[model samples]
Structure formats: C-alpha cells, structure tokens
Target: MFVGHYAAAFALKGREKEASLGWLFIATQFVDILFFPFVVWGLETMEFVPGYTETNDFKMEFPFTHSLIGSILWAIAFGGIFFLLFGRKKTSGKSIAFVLGLGVLSHWVADLFVHTPDLPLLHGEPKFGFGLWHNKAATFALEALVLLLGLWYYLKRTVAKNKFGKFVSIGFVLFLLLVNYLNYYVLPANHDIIGLTISALVSYFLFAGLAFWVDTKRT
Candidate 1:
C-alpha cells in the first residue's frame, strides 16, 4: 500500500488550511513506526508464508499496533503529543494534529481491502480482509493510482513555496514508489527473518525519507 496510504493525509491537505506536511506524513505511517519496534520486540509478527492465497504471501500477527482499537489509541497518543507541543502556540496546531491522527487510523482501514484475513476486527474476534492483493496486477494498479492521484492533488492544491520544490517532492515519491515495487515484486527472494526485517526497515526508511523531503517543500 506504500504511498497509497498518503490518501489519509491528502484528504485534508488544502482543506485543513494550515496543517504541517510533517504531521500528515506522520499520520499515515504512525502505525508502522509502532509496528517495527513492536516487531523487533516480538510483540507482533509476520511470516512469508507462501500461498497464503493465490498471489499474496504474507501473514501478520499484529495486535499491539494493527488492531482497530490499538491503532486509534496510538493515533490519539501520537496526535496528543503533537497537539501539546504545537497547539500551545497556534490553534490550528491541534486541528492538524487531530486530523493527522485520523490519518494514522486510516492505514488500517485501507489495509482491510488488500490484506489477507490476518487483520482482526477487534483484539481477537475473527480476523478479516478482502484479500485484494490476490489479484496481483489489479492490486498494484490500485495502489499506484492512489499514490499518483493523491500526490497530484497535493501538488495541485498547494504551491511549493520554493523553487523546484514540487518537482523534488514528486521525484522522491516516484523513486520511492518504484523502489517498493522493485524490492517487493522484483528483488531476489529471501524467505527468512533477515529478509522480513530488511523489508520492514526499508519500508520505514523510504517513507521517512519521502516525508522529510516533502516537509521541507511545504508551503
């Protein structure tokens, strides 16, 4: 889902009026930030279980960060910190922070479509998802479309406020998105723990870099 998740924040770009680019970026990926640490701590888990479906091949055992309630709780916790730190100086700070939390929660919502039945409704009740990725080409197409459309909308609604800024942000997004497809669908296979850790770490790195670059270009 990579860049497609940006829709969570992009939904409010110009609408929010004065939201910071960093928080929006943070919102979409806040779960992953929690996810990686939780993964390392063995509090959550994944397996490259081949043939979990026809094409999709990953199984997740994530409760601390991926559960519906856990995600909302994490969103509030992160956004609250954002509010306290930034809202004291400006009212829009809290608004932006609040919206960004919803952005964080949006990840799980979006995942529900493409993921396997690994995503739980609550902490334990029967896990569920539509398994959209089983149709590889369609899954990729939808993911790419969301990223491009959201990013295009983001660029159109806001000026770069600096020379070549929009181009730079677009450039980074393009590169990172390509990298994900390459690493995920094209790269050499590594069906092991090292492989899993590397993938998660790279995902974080790619998104964090894109966020940092976009933050700098914000109007």
Candidate 2:
C-alpha cells in the first residue's frame, strides 16, 4: 500500500485542479504518517516478522491510526485544519476540504486491499483486509496498474509548463516505480522499530516534497 496510496492523490488532483498535490500526497498517507510516530510513542505498534506477508515482513498492531473510525476522525480533523488554514479563503473551500478529507480516507481504503486483516473497525472491534499482499505478483501489478491509470488521468487533466515539467514529470513516475520495486525486492527488512519509523517518516515527507515540485512545474 505504499505508492499505491498516491494513486488517490493523482486522481484527487486531477479532479480538483485547485487542490495542492503536495497536500494531497500527505493526505493520502496521513494515517501512515501518524502510524509510525504513534509506534515510536507507544500509542500504536508493529514488529518485523519474517514471512509475515508475501510483500513485506511487518506485522502491525495499529488500532489508533489504522482503524476505520480512527481514519474517519483523522480525515475530518485534516479537513477541518485545511478549512481553517486556507480553504476558508476560497469560494470552493468546502469542496477542497471534502477532497482533502477524501484523500485522507483513501489511505485506509487502499490498505484494506493489501493488508492482512489488521485494520480494525474500531479500537477493539473486528479487523478486515483482502490480503492481496499474500500474492507478490498480484500486489505489484495492482499497484502499478492503479498508479498508471491515475497518472494518465492526471496528465490528461493538466499540461506541462515547460521542458523541465515534461521531463521531470516522467522522471518522477519512474522514480516512484523504482522505489516500489526496491521496497518489494531490494530493501532489506529492518527489525528496529525506531529506525523503521524514522525511515518511513523521511520517505513520506520526501515524496510529498517531490509531489509539490511536480505540481509547481505543471499548470
């Protein structure tokens, strides 16, 4: 559910051209961004277990951040903050806020596809997932297909502002694919939760920054 989450961002930005792609990127991963820090703070937790799933080795116990209710609450909070910060100034404020909230909720929905029934309906209620991660090839193909389709829609909705925009946009897509590949096959599993948390936070912010740059380079 890594780069697959960004498909929501791309589709969101394409639908609402006024929404910030950077923020949308953050929104799509907002719960995950919270999940890692929650892990470090002992509010939530996960562990590296070999063969936990076909795609990765992490066994998560993130009720506060990955729960269905928690996700909805976070989305509402995110939308509220956006409304107070910048959405209030625009005529399309409500629409933008809604889209941002949708982006936040999209993370949980995407995770539902690949996760191993770890996502809770509430703090202590039942958990559910489709367990797509159990199949490596299917996971990879599904992520790539969703990302490509979203990117295609985005490109159709917006045009490049210059040569740099055109080239960099393509490069960014390749970079995302490369990262996904590395995550699945190249990167070694780190058992240290703190280190994993730091890495996850860094990667999320870096991708958000890149998405911001890409947005600026386009119309």
Candidate 3:
C-alpha cells in the first residue's frame, strides 16, 4: 500500500494533466499523512509485531485516519479547499473537486488489497481487506505491477521535455522500488513505532517532492 498508492497519483495525472502531480501525489497519500501525525500524538496507534503478516509488522488502531468515513470526510474537506484555492483558476471546480476527492479515497482502495482486515468501515469493527500482505512475493508483484503500469501510462501520455525528464522519470520508479525492497527485506526488525512513524512521514514527503521535480521536468 505504500508505493502502490503512487500508482493512483500517476494514473490520475494522465487525466488531470492540468493539475500538479505533486499535489496529486500528496492527495493520494493524504490519509497516511494524517495517520503518522495522529500516531505521534497518540490519537492513533500502531505496534510493531513480527509475524503478524508477511509484509506488515504493525498492528494498527487508527480510526480517525483510516476509516472509510473518515477518509471520505477528509477527501471532501481537501477537495473543497483545493478547488477553492487552485481549481478555480484553470479548470472546472466541479471536475477538480471530484478528482481531488477521488484521489484521497484511492488510498483506502489500495490499502484494501494489501492490509489485513484492519481498515474500518466506520467507527469500529466490520473492517475488511484482502490481506495480500500474507504473501510477500504476491504483495511485491502487485505493488510493482501497479507502479510500473502507472509509469507506462504516464510516459505514454506525456513526452519527456528533456534528457533529465527521461532519466528522472525512470529513476523515480527505481528509487521507489528500492525503498519498497528495503522496507520489506532490509529494514531492521523490532524498530520502535515512533521512529517508524517518523520515517513513514518523511518518506511520504520525499516521494512527493520527487514527483514535483519529475513533473516540472516533463509536460
């Protein structure tokens, strides 16, 4: 659900080409952006428990950020604010609103595929997920395929403006895959939840920044 979330951001740019991919990247991960901070504040919680799932170690208790209702509410707020601030200038506010809202909701959809049934539908239990994370190889393949397909679509829809664009666009995907590998295979076990939360937050912004840079280099 990490880099795979970026697939939504990349695919979205093909349609919302006028919208900033940096912003779209942020939008797709908007929930986790909130989740990390909430974890830091103790408003949400997670614990690193090894062997809980093949790819996920943390048992999460995050309702305010991970719930479907919460996500929709956040999406509405973000889309409303985004449209008022930026969408009004260049495009139809209605379309931008929907796209932005959907961008936010896409996080939940992607998480549904990889996470255990910990994602809540509303306030509490009745959570659901396909739990692809139970199988490491399958999870990796799913994330890689989504990310690669997104990159392919993006490359097809927009031609590189310079050599840097060509190089960085490809590099960006490699970098994300590298990070994914490290997270799944190389990161130290039994890491503190606080440090992990901070790292996750930092990674989100780092990827978003890369998206901004790549967007500027391309169309």
Candidate 4:
C-alpha cells in the first residue's frame, strides 16, 4: 500500500484546505506507523517469505494495527486529540478533526485494494483484500493513477503562492512517483524485519516533513 496511501493525504488536503497536509500525511499512515513499532515490540508480526506476493515478500500478522475495528479506534483517537487541542480556537476545528480521522481510516480502505487478505475484521481470521498485489504492473499502475489523481485534485483546489510553490509541488509529486517505481522495481526485498522497520519509520517521517515544507510553500 506504500505511497498509494498518500492519495488519501492529498485528497484530504484538497477537501480541507485548512487542515495541514503534513498532518494528513501522518494521519493517513498512522496505523502503518504504529504497525512497524508493534512488530518490533512483539505486539504484531511480519515474516519475509520470498515470493509471498508478486510485489514483495511480507507475510504480516498485524491485527492490532491493521484490523477494521482497530483502525476506527485509532481514527477516533486522532480526531479526538485534534479537537481537544484546537476546537476552541478555530471554527473549522471539528471539520479538520473529521478530515484527519478520515485520513486515518482511509489507510485500511486503500490497503484493501492491494493487500492479500491480511487485514482483519477484528483480532484474527475472516481477513479480506482484493489482492491486487498479485500483479506487479497492475499494482504499479493503480498506485500511480491514484496518486496522480489526488495530486490533480490538490493542485486544482489550491493556488500556488509563489514560483517555489508551483515547482516544488510538481517536483514532489514526481518524486513520489519515482519512489513508488523504486519500491516495486529497484529496491531489493528486505529480509531483516528490524532494519525494515527502521527504514519504514524513517521514510514515513521524511515524507511527512517534505509534505509540510511543500504545504508551507503553497498557502
């Protein structure tokens, strides 16, 4: 689901211009952000079996972070915290909170399209996914299409504040596409769970920071 998740971030920013795009980026990947640490803590699990899926080799057992109910709870928690922090100061606070919560929940919905029945309804079993990851080309195309559409919507809704805003926004979108390409075609399948978790966390925060900078350059 990787960069495909950021489609939700862009869409959320488009719909709620007042909401921070950077925060939306974090919200959209909130569960996955938690999933990696959970894996390291023995609260969840993942094993790299070569050829587990056409795209990568991750066989995950992440009920607490990937379950439908768990996502809902996480969404509520995120939205609740936002409301608590800003509800009194801004008229659109509730709206921003809802958008952030939706961003959090959107991760599961997006993953449902590509994951191979790893997402759970509760703690175990009855897992579900459309398994789009079975085909590499389809996975790549779908992610690119979704991300481009999101970027288009975002650009449509927000006007650039300066030259840097216009060019950086475009460059960032291209950068995301490049990262996606490398994820599918260039990067070797990582076998070390610990190393993978560290890299995943670093990438998540790095992208969020970049999104924040881009948003600042805009409006």
Ranking by TM-score: 4, 2, 3, 1
Tens digits of per-residue lDDT, candidate 2, 67-128, equal: 99999999999999999999998998888899999999999999999999899988665889
lDDT of the structure predicted as candidate 3: 0.86
**What would the per-residue lDDT of candidate 1 be over residues 89-130, giving only the tens digit for each residue?**
885787877787888888898888888777775677788788
Local lDDT at 95 for model 3: 76
Assess the local accuracy of residue 5 in candidate 3 as a C-alpha lDDT between 0 and 100: 90
Ranking by lDDT: 4, 2, 3, 1
Per-candidate alpha-carbon RMSD to the true structure:
2.3, 1.1, 1.4, 1.0
Give the Cα lDDT of each candidate.
Answer: 0.73, 0.90, 0.86, 0.91
Runs of candidate 3 exceeding 4 Å displacement: none
Question: Model 2, residue 74: what's the lDDT?
Answer: 97
What TM-score, over all chains together, does every model reach? 0.87, 0.96, 0.94, 0.97
* Cα error of candidate 1 at position 8, Å: 2.4
The CA lDDT at 216 in model 3 is 92
Q: Indicate which candidate wins on lDDT.
A: 4
Better of 2 and 4 by lDDT: 4
lDDT value, candidate 2, whole model:
0.90
